[model samples]
Target: MFVTNVERREERKGPPAGGRALDLLGKMERNEREYDETIAYALALASAWSYADPQALHDVMNSLGFENRCYAVTLSNDAVSARTSASLLQHVDGSAAILCFRGTEPASTGARLADTGVEPARLHAWKAVQGGVHSGREPMARYIACRLKRAMNGQSIVDEKGELVSVDAPACSDATGEPLEHRLKALYITGHGLGGALAALAAAMIFEDKEHEGIRDVVRGVYTYGQPRIGNEIFARRCQDTYGRLLFRHIHANDLVPMFPPPSIGTFEQFGHELRSSAAGWVFSEQPARRADTAPFGSTVDVLAWVKQRLPLVRRLQRPFSSDEHAPHRYVSVSQRSLRLRRSELGLSLGRLRG
Candidate 1:
């Protein structure tokens, strides 16, 4: 059946009415049994890119229909340092470019760093995007964000065999002589574990429309697996307002990494679509409907009332912090199943899907 305009609006937002949760589950296919394979390939590619080996990461990018692969590396280890590795790839079709962050690596100190950075619910001002800051949101894991920021600024690219790479080329300029924010039609960011948290924060930054730089109007989606909370309440709401269902958290049974920096310990929260694997198959859960006016906020007047409303949610999101369920391949397996549907049939525009 054709979805009416009002229905689509209601699906993305919510019924023009009251909501109890964060209004995540908008309009989803109720009886749909199949998933989109193309999305699976893209996600699989992202999972592979998380590895540190350049040659291996390069090979994975090629398999996923991407070219002009670039790798992001971070060297700082202090509160102001960036430690994780990320990569960039322009889709072979030239429809989109992707920023993929590698999740927590074995014996990596960054994997255990306590969340420290915090800021308001905004991106680094276009004019003040210095000091390696991406979003104003806190608990952003400063080290990780710093690394990614440096990688982006460097704009380094890797060759086919991952042999030739450089940061020597100057930045690109548009035909009109304006600086391009990024060259691809759209930007899609993804990661697992710590990378997932960084990816989420990065997604929030990419969609912000401030000033000066290439226009990244096409932020395709921020897809994450076993991702932990990345920001405070206000930041979460900002992401929800900006991306709606385009933000995805793919959870497998009992994955523990998603439970980090427990919501009870801080203002952290998840923002976007939530899909989980089940005994039968995989299932997607939109946040329960919520209204900004009614939802509990940090500024709420009654502390008792706010805790009463939020405690349950925090407990529900926490899982034991140990499990093989946190792996990336497991995420790809389930996401491929639940994300099935062609763009035309999904009622989404080709621009968002391809770009």
Candidate 2:
């Protein structure tokens, strides 16, 4: 029932008081050209805002009807990231900016920008990726934890040491007195599957806490990879019922994390309704899973090489004949009563396939 083919259902609903917003979003999704145009407009606005005078930028945003204080905050964060990557926010207003930079040497570019009078109100700097202290709050850490737990459980995990244990445990402090150990948390589990499950569990715990207080709308974002767990669905539905805003789950198609084998109810489809309504939902961006040569065993080598090395024996597994050749045997194996029940329940025409 969860995987029903119907495009619309009464049980599925949008945020209260946001009917117009939902309509606009739905229209955008239905028209790919319009959707892309909107994105281009947003990007252009961002680009123009970056070069406009601070006051002019403010006026432009205000004229566009984006008056929410939170919108400004989100925009500021986006601006900061943009500036770091492509100078897209270089000339934007810096009076209210909170700049957080991650890289080795803290990138002299930021310092030069400050020297040039592009003073950010707040700045926090750290080494990029695996260079600095490991924070358990990050998705990569959660992934490592999941794999470690699976390995400890006697599952065949590949590149366990390379992926999970490659980083040295924190041993020193920066110029600031913050201890590296305090910055990183040890992972409690292992594997992308379990990592996704752990993220759902974390979200569920937060939802439950908010529920106990009779408070909703306390959460703003929930980012996770791969398929959804049963607990995730329960929590997500509850969040929607109580607060109306749904969680955002990101899944790269080629990663195979979001779509595991066997058709079943998944978090991706469950949240698809919400994504269809969100302002910037369901962005099918490129994820470096296969491109980066990442594998189930957590190796960074070429995907084919890693697979061949780790699962060489699987190459000998028998291959199935074409679906057309196998169809008759598959149908003959089904019980008459079961077929009748399926036909009655789903209105399917198996005879069409036979024909």
Candidate 3:
């Protein structure tokens, strides 16, 4: 049966279309050693493309032989919060899943406001979670976690006819028609900007859920691009303790969104490894750089202050092109290029070993 808010169409089905998704998934299947970087870059590309068009993403997944394995869900906008959208893509063997959240929409005033709002919120769903998270993101993260749990549990939803309908897609089940919890191994979460922040928090929410104990460990990784700080130091510590090297936050060249809701305004902080984009490729760091003397300041105000103090004339003449820095296209382009180079390097290393 179809999921309550999730849309899964079955009208058009065909063989794998051999697109980027198929190519990347093929690489994973062919070489286990490359899975980590390949999957991360694949998710990064998917996250950036999701903001432009969700349907295109569905089509891409379908071409990658996902077919009925793809589902898109959208939570309606309320007076208080803007609409939130997410998509789930499952591997054909039920071995892995990717949950991608749509980033902030430019046309939505509510989303724009949420990006700027620095308020803290402690969600009841998070149980005894140590600290508060971005008020704007908590609810959306909770919603996403709940839906993912339902999909994994193969829970049913009531249709308009007042009948219980199984919401499990073929990807979530085995040939015996049973839920594939055993086969369901790895789960990857990803998004860009506000969506990235939600992806990070949703992983935390899933872990905090006792009911999700069966599936929480399946959360293999959380890959976020240009995401603002989602929670405070305590929350960050808990996440770092739980995910460790599995958590990756990618910051494209000078992305302004990632440096937001300054620590001065709230206790917010970023945890996990940082993948700062460079001309050479992605440079990995233990944590994000925040000091004024370092690159990638903690907030927009810090950026302005740095510019004003060091080069007032340049600051006045050329205002920070913050939006361009945060653009989804930039993330997509850089990630794809980096992935290519990574593959080339690995190939050369293999050749040397063979020699």
Candidate number achieving the greatest lDDT relative to the actual structure: 3
Q: Write down the TM-score of every candidate.
A: 0.58, 0.24, 0.71
Clash count per candidate: 14, 9, 0
**Candidate 2 clash total?**
9
Task: Give one digit per residue, the lDDT tens place, for model 3 in 202-312.
Answer: 777667767667767567678888877776677777877876456788887665667665555566678888988887567786657452221233244344645664775
lDDT of 2 at 9: 35
- Candidate 1 residues 242-264, lDDT tens each? 76457767777755555544333
Candidate 2 lDDT over 17-100, as tens digits, reads 122222222222233222232222222232223232334433433333322111111111233322211110111111111111
Candidate 1: segments with Cα more than 4 A from true spot: 1-37, 78-82, 92-94, 106-183, 212-214, 279-281, 287-321, 336-355
What is candidate 1's local distance difference test score? 0.47
List the candidate 2 regions with Cα displacement exceeding 4 Å: 1-193, 210-218, 232-236, 243-246, 260-269, 272-355
Error of 3 at 34 (Å): 9.4
Q: By the lDDT metric, which is better: model 1 or model 2?
A: 1
**Which ranking of candidates, highest TM-score first?**
3, 1, 2
| CA lDDT, candidate 2, residue 136 | 16
